[model samples]
Target: MPAESDLCSLLALGPRPGRDAREGACNHGQVTADEVFFREWQARAAGETRSLARARALAEVLGVLPAGVPVLVVVGSKGKGTAATYASACLAAAGLRVGTVTSPGLRGNRDRIRVNGQAVSEAEFASLAERLERAIGSLPPRTGGYLAPTGLFTLSGVVQARERGADALVLEAGMGGLGDEVSLFRPEVVAITPIFSEHVGVLGDTPAAIATEKAGVVDALTRHVVSAPQTPAVAEALERTVEARTRKKGLVEYVEIADVPQEHLPPGLVQRAAQVGCSAALRLLEGEGLALPDAERLEAVLSTVVLPGRLSWHRVPGADTEVLADCAINGTGVAMALVTARERWANIDHVVLCLPDHKDLDGAIAALGALPVTFVRLPYERLRFTRPLPSSWEVIEAAELTPDRLAGLGRHVVALGTVYFIGQILDLVDADTTRLFTAP
Candidate 1:
């Protein structure tokens, strides 16, 4: 492995001179040697392809992922990470060691990769990062595309799972699933969550188009499939794609809103996702001829899983104030959060937004419906790349986000933004991020 100074030099290979250095990148600071190398590795994906080729190449070079492990790939616009986490918990309860890979870590970058519901240790991640760096450097100069951060993490998660003797793997695809790096693995079961219109230009213009792309995860290797209730257009697209991809023997079950009782799940979008994930786990186990757990046992296991930043309530550390935080990156997500808040809390006093400029501000405003709104001005240290805040919106300094000060702003507040922004709030409140998969 290269020395710290040598690895820092890799930052020079970042995006073009005029391009924003923070686009799909991390902030550079007094970080560890592994973090420095990983950030530079992520920079190499600038203007490169977002496909499986580069990820496959990296896996081949490292040759670490074990074969023949039953795999489950979860793909959708939202709730994918939660669904994958739920499925992993169920599999673990069934006595199989499971490895799970989700995106946008709640506490840090390494938390996105886990085994048996626990994040990889710092030492393990550092060692894996060093190995990945060496493999990436050894690749031929003519390699088609560079490995993105998500691809590298997914590959590392696979290696960690192998080292940990995991019996199964659950991978959550980033954004729309077609051509995603996770698709490189042949999954035994594929779970689809509700589809929403997102990444307009890059993925598709409409929900139907995005559904078609995401449905590509249901390849021939997928024997059984489960999907949350979707729009008419999305359902039609998914059915068509599944029919073409798999033989007539493949079974595709579309879960309905009625399928998940309100008594069994927490309020909001998690209900639909939990139903799909639980059903998928059941189907996968049944296919393997394993004895299914009793309904009570399954429910008990599912109840322990928590989805961070999805209308989750947090009490400020050393303060009496409590706030609801949601990782709503776009308009649709914000709308869902608002609906959840109204149904659960009845009245909302204030809404705080920490989103980037490229997000759907207009849609979010429309969904807010005249509610009092405050926009947080995050410093470059927290988020390196962001456009100027609008002059018309009320702005507050990120420094004033302490618990006592936040309570002074409003009695009932809802914090909404990207996963990173919500993660900041969780850290501010000292939430127990490590216990997300297990009961308190």
Candidate 2:
């Protein structure tokens, strides 16, 4: 294996993609080479239909399908990562080695791909990175754009999982399911979290339209699907899409808020993710004629799993403050985070927002409602404010938010923004994101 810096240089050898690509380099605080690769690949891919085609071609080159294990594809606007992680946990607890691939890694890029709760080692990642580059280079040119970074990472995870002998694979879709790279495989099970309006212009303008795109994950091979509670329009879209895809021969299960007993839940969006994830695992086991594991074991696994960046609390060294970071980019998500914060802590002294221009600022402000709190805005390249700054709010650069500054601000602070921004916060506080699930 090459030295860490050598691996970084080798990966960075290719031409930077997109216009003014250099400008897209890491603008946040110190980041690892893997993080740099993630941002660079994100800049390269457009996540369009053409990009999907390129990803499919790359898959063909790698020959990654007929995945010799039961595959689960988790898709939705939010909570997909949580749901996927839980499902992996349930499967692992039931005596199966599970691999999962999620987007926008919380701490490090390697965190996006894991098998049975442990991240792939740097040596393994570097080897696969070399193979992936060779395969992409060998592909014939086409009209499609660059393969999406999310798709590339998903493919890398698949390769890593297969090499590591994973018995099952769980995939969390990117922004949209149909166009996502993970849709390349025909999964045995598909899990749907709550569908809402997000990625408005790219996926579709409404919840139903976006749901339609997500529903595309239910290919002919899918025998079972479990969904969390969804709005009428979104549910209808899922129903129509599933019916057409399955030809009325498949089973669809819905998990309502009431369906999940409150006593077993861990609060906030985790409750919904737990409900949907367990349901999906149960359905998958039933389809395979495998006996369910001990209920206590499953519950224990669910209770212990740590989902970072979704109301996850971390303490900064040398600081009296504790940061509660959430990757809530929309109004509904922001509102849920606020509720969770209020319930977890008596008072939220400050609210820090690092939102993109396209985020629902007005709706987020409306949700904040009458709370006597200070608002801090931390701006990044992809997560900048759209309008003029508020006179009362304090604006800080990502580099300036150190332990000392954060401590002086307040004892309890809520950080809200895209996953990337939250990653910055996690990096700043040096949060432990190495583990997502644990084996029984």
Candidate 3:
């Protein structure tokens, strides 16, 4: 049978036989299944010389297509995804076709890319993946003899968005500013949210270094630069970077979160940051000849914007207790989550805490030092680092705590920290089983 036909047949048989039968034949570029074919193709691409350069060349080809559109790039230490979502929603609300790409999806792979708040269909993603695999084949080898497929994938998504004639492309940077794959496109408006310490390995050690890295998204001002309020160290670094690069090129505008009246500042700074993002979007749209209705009407819309896993809240069943889960993997986010939790639930006496491997344990402990309460550590098997608590704090296994036992402690139990752990807790709560306690 032909190679494509054989591949199709193998895939039709499903994963088990395909995995066992196609071992050696698949690796040597002999196509046995779609999965094996893609893996082989990726392996060959990895053997190329200059993957990023080739990826850039491929992007150049994609860029020349007749579907050029304005792009908005959102960069920050945290809340970039939420801000991007708000911007996309506002644009969509204004009758514009908006395509948004955000990282670290909460659910499925398709959640990373959305056009007007709707995920791309499975058929569309598969078709794009197939076309992208072909595009990678045409690129030459890199200097180190490895082809980079990540850049091609990113470019493919961008191309697909443009092909659909999207009015605006909203992209959230994956890492620090300069060398990130999202930086490949020259955005019409570049907005930077607040900065905090994160990705210490890829970004620099201090908050200032991270700020500089995030500010790398701002190039010569051929596009507008929207600066969100930042901490002293971060704001100064961003101001310097913006002035130096875009001084003679394009306009640099700063949106002061503090300037917005206190009544309009939402309940928290994260919400304020999101509000700033909406304002920036309005400004960008107005510049593009799209008029917004009014500040009050826009604020009404902004008040209802919800981004999951960032200060997201849910009510506990059969109780008045509410669970607040935020992605507090770093010092900044932890501080923010703590403050927000305290402000929202001042009288709560206990908290169910689950610390992920990525979080700063010492810092989080210190940040919560001000509160007088009990800490019940949720039982989570997926954690990379699981050990007994330090002498300073008390830890309780999630399994041992019953609804009756929990109700005896206090009227409310705040579940804070990693969203993954929160998800596990929610799953256990939904099942109405004491699995969290008995599993270990």
- What lDDT tens digits, residue by residue, belong to model 2 across residues 129-155? 777777877877645365556777789
RMSD score of candidate 2 (Å): 6.4
Q: Per-residue lDDT of 1-440 in model 3, one digit per residue for the tens?
A: 01221121222222222122223222312122134213432345322332345556666655623227777788886667767877776676566777777654343234456676666665666666666566656666444433222233346557667767778778877555665556677666777877777556447778888878777766663357776766888777777776676674335566764423345333444665666566667766876888664556545544555555556665545776665656665555666777777787866566556665556776766666645434445333323456444565566654454544444546555556654444334432332211101100
Per residue, candidate 1 scores C-alpha lDDT tens digits across 315-353 of 766666667889787777788888877776768878888
Candidate 2 Cα lDDT to native: 0.72
Residue 290 miss distance in model 1 (angstroms): 1.6
Q: Model 1: runs farther than 4 Å from truth? A: 1-30, 33-42, 64-66, 142-144, 257-262, 329-349, 356-360, 366-370, 377-393, 397-404
- lDDT by candidate, in order shown: 0.70, 0.72, 0.56
The lowest-lDDT stretch of 10 consecutive residues in candidate 1 is 1-10
What TM-score, to 2 decimals, does candidate 3 have?
0.69
Best candidate (score: lDDT): 2
Per model, state how many residue pairs clash. Answer: 0, 0, 16
Q: What TM-score does candidate 1 reach?
A: 0.82
Q: Total backbone clashes of model 2? A: 0
Each prediction's TM-score versus the true structure:
0.82, 0.85, 0.69
Ranking by lDDT: 2, 1, 3
Residue pairs whose backbone atoms clash in candidate 1: none
Best by TM-score: 2
